[model samples]
Target: MGYNNLCEIGEERIRRAGEKIKSEIEAENAQLTLDSTPKKVPDIGFRVLRVDDSNYEDRRKNVGSYSQADLDFDVDITKSDRSNLDLLFEALPKFQLPYDVRINTLSGDEFDGHTVYSVDDGRLLACFEADIPESLVRAMAAFSPRPSYALVSEHSLPDSAARTNFVEIFKQSADSKTGSTKPYII
Candidate 1:
């Protein structure tokens, strides 16, 4: 509320500015005496609203345009420009995850160098990197606290075998943990 200006910018820049402003306010506050604390900054922040094309490609056709050939093949519904983050956020509301839910970006050698987004402290885990490996799927399944949902883009799997392995790894993980199959969304 103390601020006088607002700017709309790219996601990365906004994130950086938010971090910078938070730190600067904290530093300034730390220097203030008890009496001067009255002049301290108020709770300040920014909300990000991304305006862009839909994450999915439009594959719909008129009733008369639907041909038998269309039924024989698969089509990728995701648009080419959509990033993993875009798809991840788009899925949040569909799953009814809270808007304020915490999302952690995880990437390390342990995850096989793939970026994984841990939602609500691993209650929901999502990875959209291409050519996702079996090891990464297993790692996600083995996440601490055990995610209730494990999500990955269909196109991320290199082949049918990888997709099968992904399901199996999570299924086995659930089975071992609960001594039965648990309802884990994937």
Candidate 2:
């Protein structure tokens, strides 16, 4: 292999190892039947992640120069290269969603105009779409089995009215009447 560093080789090796384990598990699972005693299969998989620079761009190079209010203005909040899976992996721990749980993307009709990913029913909802639509905000506010936590891209939501709608929506969604989504956006 013409690899330069350990990271490259390690990533590839890890990927292959996971594939090997999954195949083994599938082969084992194929043997289970109602007539035969079911054997429990231990979960075997890996989540490979890499470290990088901050996804958000700072207008002022110096953090001291920017105030809390400055973030409200125009600034690219998320890096373009970031994908749904990347955001989902990053947000999973933050939102306290478990790695072992399987996550599925919500059907387009579920949120209509917006892409939604769900984990453990609606315990954690991640909306990674940029330029979130108003319809989505309203739908999320009224979301059934209201999400315990939500994550959105920082600059994805550009409209203040939509944000305000979310505030009201969160208030209504919360069983405690706090109406908060406890949202975390990267």
Candidate 3:
């Protein structure tokens, strides 16, 4: 699918999943508040919900075993309108969302792929697709800080400790090509 199409799909999936979790929480609240259960324990409202790609197996499996991309969705329970339990359920559908990346080269070579990396301190996230040469990889490694994981489209394998360095290098290349200083945040 086209890049725009993929982005749309990802947004829609997140929104739908968010709404579903909201509804479920509302329903449970209504049930617990019924007159028959008036004497039951008080309900604690939800505070936050966090959804990420790793939460879903199908998405992970679809991207292949070596995929390196991940998505994270977070809903604050303390600030959320739903109860604590609602936040829990709201995070469920996030695992089903789809994410992919496509790379193209001046030589017409292409690479397409996806991933589901979870969030962690000091962990760098990256995705690359292109007909990259060893010289370019070396150049990228030269200035960029090394990351914990690297997902290169051409090779379905993830580089655990050197991803950050390459991503920084690739960002520079992309910036130079696009004639812009803003790095692709995704």
Candidate 4:
């Protein structure tokens, strides 16, 4: 087959796989539902932003303090498929993306705490929570220039032997043009 034909086939396979996983997740969970489907398929992708203490210092001294940003993404799944989504999330570590990553759902919250390890290729993974606030979701979707994915991280030094690093990576996106200079404190 031609390259385009092969590519189309591959995409079809991926779509079928996603559909199958969605079905399985629905079968396992009873509360999940497809609240809204995107009118058009998004350009699904990922981005990574790195913030080391040295970089922060350089930016602060020259470019001002780095701004705090939030990342957002959407998954087409019903409440019933939450379990399957969790399973898929757990399976991401095995893909060998140059990082050992874990996303654990914190108690009393709807989503999980994303923990990244051994990051060599600047990739992190996590699952989405159903109860994300609409305003926050809208804000996250409104990043200027709208990246398919976004990564925000910061570095700090506070009289410690080692510098502190706070990083967040996102897998969904939209177009918002507001900018701020708030620092992420994690």
Q: What are the RMSDs of all candidates, in order?
A: 6.4, 4.6, 19.9, 18.9
Per-residue lDDT tens digits for candidate 2, residues 1-186, read: 998999889878987887787778778778878687645555555555677665555555477777767756544556668778776776677766677667868857758846788788877777877788767866766677777777676566776666666566666666665345666545
Listed in order, each prediction's TM-score against the native is 0.67, 0.66, 0.20, 0.20
Give, for candidate 4, the lowest lDDT window spanning 10 residues: 159-168
Q: Pick the candidate with the highest TM-score.
A: 1
lDDT of all predictions: 0.74, 0.69, 0.35, 0.31
How high is the lDDT of residue 62 in model 3? 45
Compare candidates 3 and 4 on lDDT and give the better one.
Answer: 3
Clashes of 4: 11
Candidate 1 Cα outliers beyond 4 Å, as residue runs: 1-45, 51-53, 61-75, 175-186
lDDT of 4 at 20: 69
Better of 2 and 4 by TM-score: 2
Name the candidate that leads on lDDT.
1
Q: Tell me model 1's lDDT, rounded to 2 decimals.
A: 0.74
| Superposed model 2: Cα runs more than 4 Å off | 1-34, 37-44, 61-75, 88-102, 176-180, 184-186
Model 1 Cα shift for residue 1 (angstroms): 17
Clashes (candidate 3) = 21
